[model samples]
Target chain A: MNLPRKEWAAALCALPASEVKHLANVLSGELEVRDVALPHAGLGLLNLRDGAFEESYFIGEIPVARAEVIVRSAGGMEERGGALIVDDRAQFARSIAILDAVMAGKLPGSVPAMTLVQRGMEVRQQKQIERKKLLTATRVDFSLLGQEDDEDEE
Target chain B: MSYVAIKGGKAAIDGAASASEYLRSKGSLDEPLTLAMIEEQLRLLTSRVVSEGGLYHPRLAALALKQFQGDTLEAAFALRAYRSTKPRLLESPVQDTANMRCIRRISSAFKEVPGGQYLGATYDYALRLLQLDLANEDPAAFKAVAKSFLRDTPETELPDNFPKVIDSLRAEGLLPPVAPSRAAAFDITRDPLVFPVPRSAALATMARAETGGLLAMAYSNMRGYGDVHPTVAELRVGYLPVMLPHPVTGELMEAGEVLVTECEVVAMYEGTNGDELPTFTLGYGACFGHNEVKAISMAILDRALQKGMQDGPTNPSEDPEFVLLHVDGVDSMGFASHYKMPHYVTFQSDMDRLRTTQQKMQQKESEATT
Candidate 1:
């Protein structure tokens, strides 16, 4: 699904915890965001469904940290950015808010912000590929011994 | 009967808290119990907390362990409580276990699979005797002995993906064809579980269930209380990638990897044909971390719950309500611990009823004597 610019920014903010933290650190030097709201921790429910794909059930709760910020572009146009982080990293959420604002405002340096997100995704994909390779080595291959037996009765 | 609330125990409660803290820190001031030690040495416990908490962060689980002073249930509770504070951003795409990076994989049904079975880091063959030498052993000596066990040369690497055991049976029509799940995945945390719970909800509940509770129910089934004889089809310990849909392109993107234990057990079932032939049905269990027993028990329970569909429920384990309601550590612990709370009003009422009955019985006895 093609996401709007703000949603895309939120997705970037929602990158894997370590990657998001790193991206935030890198972007903090490039952009300045005014606090629209203070970052805080909250809770969210995780839902589950049965094997039959029938009804939903409540599993448990998950901690979420969120932050909101406003950014002003070089042209003096301001836009709000918000982040809903999955864990309890307040600083990381704040950084996400800044990046979100930067992207939402369509700031001059937003291209670099998008590039950082792409790089983060690439790194994650590379790691996954390597992990899959190691796991694939463990797959059990079975050797068939006899000629195929076909039974037909009408 | 009357009851009054007790007040003004704040000082005593404060003192008790202080005493507990002092006791926890009394042993040593120099060398502290580190989170690293708990995460590494007590890995199974940490894994249990993570699995039960339904969160994958080992560091947070370790901290919870420290805070709870190594009470697994309480640690899990703390983790769950912490999890509730976090927000839900996006649901990860379904993980394919076939693509997992497996560190260990085994099957009891097959003597050999395409890739040889890897018995990695298991205690199955080790003697149960405790090493008394470890009580005051030097760290350097322990490291030396551990290093001695490592192989100088690496063995030939195994293949990446193995064919699922169930797939072979399905190919030959020995197993029933399973329709793909059509319902959207549900979060057990978000909704209360109702009767006839979906397999996903049951598995989710069991995944975080207390190990002993699950084991007891599973043991009952194995001991003939229920009808299931399970053979380990596949038991694997691995890391599966968590993927999310890309916001811009909508392509699935790898988010991260979570360590998990996945198990599939094959159980005997009556064939659909008119003849008295037998076929195989599958029971699956998976959870965070490398807990084989929990996973296996979960698999057993998963199959047992299915017995209700084929045969009328004859056993307690086969009842979804009985099994699911009693398995959660948090719920059980809360109920169990609540007994310690004051029951003044209820107890006073019971005492009054007993006294009245005793007075009536005594008066009748005196009249009979007169």
Candidate 2:
């Protein structure tokens, strides 16, 4: 409740797909959501412009999923939240909307929602570190160039 | 000449399909080709598919590659076909390439750029010799070597953004001032291309064009067919962020990042706008992947087309209609292969005309002999 509902929604939306799915499963029993707007999938255009901003162009379209839901808290308070996710996962979009509504209502389960997001962030960071290590190992070493040059000269 | 029309042969067509599928699966049944391997190992191929298909989904591109059995053109075609099925949503905000998280940046015009040139994952200096040991090498050993290489390389910190070379040129008044485009981007997929099409539409067409076709046209220009001798002012391979305006707050939010290859070509163009001073004009090319040759060729073609606009187009590359129409692999492929279809009636008509001409010539020869 202390944190802005928008920030909470952003955090929830930012979580990895697996983490979001896990969180949804964890919180599905605790919250009740009525569909304000049914989840739908559509395409969003990626507009590109020239260097001088001379003209805008549609490069291509990307799949977008959107949903809106109204959450009814145990305390008899209701809040509506809208979600616009940038993929074709209609279920994920629906879950995100529910999470947003729950955050907006400041329900008792909001504490778990925040903690789940934090956990997801930590996991993502750890994965990023591992990936960096792997990529660093593959870096081409230019230092052994002198040795190769000497061999070529002989 | 005799010709007969036959009914449908659905069973034969079905058998042919089964045979092709069987051939694809026969050899690789023991160890199947995984999508991850295709994505990682054949990265350049996958990138080309993504770029030419005008789609950014790696998984879909990988699936396309699998379905097409590593045929790059076919994979690109498949991806494009898949793209046609999807719906258009909203236009993303203009992405600033100057702020791209650059992995590789180089300039051929200048010996050095503001941030030093970093040649990341390039084959420019690599020896072209085939590695014979790869044929019999253990897969686990290969993985181990790759892992060790990644572990040993020292990490160097790079700046978050790199300065554009053209911007510096503009500051020094070396480049010509660009007029703002009258319209927003033209969607090549939806709108029919009118001749003397906007530069944006032409560029969009080239972005998804067959790399080989673009290269041949550009190569001809570089070899003295057209009037564009360009220096690579900047070639950058990096991730460009895709930002979308938030539905709720109406502020730009980072949706994702797409790996793109961008090239800025510096060329001398005689000004047609009554300006006596010849100014350095820029030709720009950017595509969905790290295809350097495609980007460079596209940039040269972009410049070559500009010359045609000022003076009447003298070369094929300079003609927008000629260049754009032939570059699409799908269109070219479909038309080229259409000859495989049954043309029995036309063939018989041609044969009858040839026989009539031969009989008349024989009759004339007999009369002369008599």
Candidate 3:
């Protein structure tokens, strides 16, 4: 639960490399950071259950990047923050982990990281709204088939 | 017969690849094809590559599409080849399709369902007439087009939840309940697929099988080779969120989402066990990206194969071995293309047999004449 969920983690991961790198660049100068786990991009086989037998099988591997880092604050407080996103960049993973650590420990730049999250979430929500609008526009009205009554059923 | 290995023209072979690339690139000098364009313009083609490629990386799929000069089979081959280099990190927790954020959903069997039938972004009803304007399309025009559509679109909330059509059938006791397997489902990548595969393994193979190949097998049954005439219960296309256990917390959380197409089909039920009552049998199909035809074909074939397994196959489509063995495009392409390889040794051996047989026949004829 401490880690960012799918919604915002996607945005964090999708941040332009220059922007994420800029933030991580600044943070590295301030905080004593060390990789608890080396940042690396890898593959994860997505397991899916069948509609027939509920039997699970590997559908395919999604490109992913994950990193874990221990952030040390000036007060000698330490927090381990992890970042995992659906991306294929190791550098992005490390940068996002730094952002995650800052936000988790509420470090100096926590406000800025939170700012990015809000901005990205809004962008995502706007796209979703537009998509939902299109969905509303295209919903099937089956009244032509003498099912005028059923349109109101749902 | 053993192939005679011949070596030479290494430079020419490499030059041939470059020449092919030049031919593909020649027409477009000022404007070059981008990965985004390939992914967007060739949506279905890219989806096929992702599905058949057995990988979910769209950027890489686009690259493969571009690199292979839009040869889907080669693109898929490139992806599978790329996957061999990366380390397998983790196996995701099982995902439920019921949680899909569907962009398009329809049920052929029912007129209405829990969620209203959404007819989103399909060319099914559109005319096949050429739109010549696309040849000189302005990329920036999307802003105007999207804005105009948005202005007309009435605001309505997208229902996050969509109940499965099969769920209602099972509740009504019209369909058999699916019990979870006691053992782990088969992983085809790690294990060799032997005959008499489990349902999971069969589904996995069909999921990644080539679109044309799977269609051909399914079409055989539809054209009266087999008896499994199915009505699609539901077909959905959407972004299915993948859940992975948090590495640190060990709690399940959504990792990411991938575009997928899923189909559930209902077929004629027959009494199999003496004690059990007949219920409508189910066939399920799903794949990495939005290939509706592939999904439906896979579903039909799944039902057919299950029928073949349960009661014994009467036709090729019903036979699991026949369907699975022949539906892979890469495998078929490789085997078929290998015919162009040096077959001189075999041809010579055949020629020698024919000459000897002809000489014997000639001597017998000469003796008879004399």
TM-score of candidate 3 to 2 decimals: 0.94
How close is every model to the real structure, measured as TM-score? 0.77, 0.87, 0.94
Query: Top DockQ: which candidate number?
Result: 3
As for candidate 3, its clashing pairs are: none
Tens digits of lDDT, candidate 1, B1-370? 2445788878988998899778778976667678988898888889898888777777888999988888988888888787666656555445566766777788887757545666656787789999898898898987786445333323444455555666676667776566756676556777798877777778778878888899899999999998789988788887764444433234554433567787888887666656544668778777778899998998899888988645757898898889999998888997897777678888988999999999999999999999
Scanning candidate 3 chain A in windows of ten residues, the lowest lDDT window is A1-10
Tens-digit per-residue lDDT, A7-40, candidate 1: 4433564356576666666655555557766778
lDDT of each: 0.69, 0.73, 0.83
Q: Give the higher-DockQ candidate: 1 or 3.
A: 3
lDDT of each residue in B1-370, candidate 2, tens digit only:
3335667867888998899778889967477788988888888988888877777777778889988778778888887788778766566776677767666777887744676566767889889999899889898998898667556765545456678877787778788776767777778888988888888888888888888888998998999998788989888887776666545555565555677888889987556567556678778777877799998998999888877765768998888888888888777876776677677888989999999999999999999999
For model 3 chain B, the run of ten residues with the poorest summed lDDT: B245-254
Candidate 1 wrongly placed segments (more than 4 Å): A1-27, A30-154, B1-4, B141-161, B273-278
Give lDDT tens digits, candidate 3, residues B54-131. Answer: 989888999999988889999998999898899887777789988888888899888888788987778989999999
**Best-first order by lDDT:** 3, 2, 1
Q: Which DockQ-derived CAPRI band holds candidate 3?
A: medium
Tell me, by lDDT, which candidate is best.
Answer: 3
Q: Ten-residue segment with the worst summed lDDT in candidate 2 chain B?
A: B246-255
* Total backbone collisions, model 2: 15
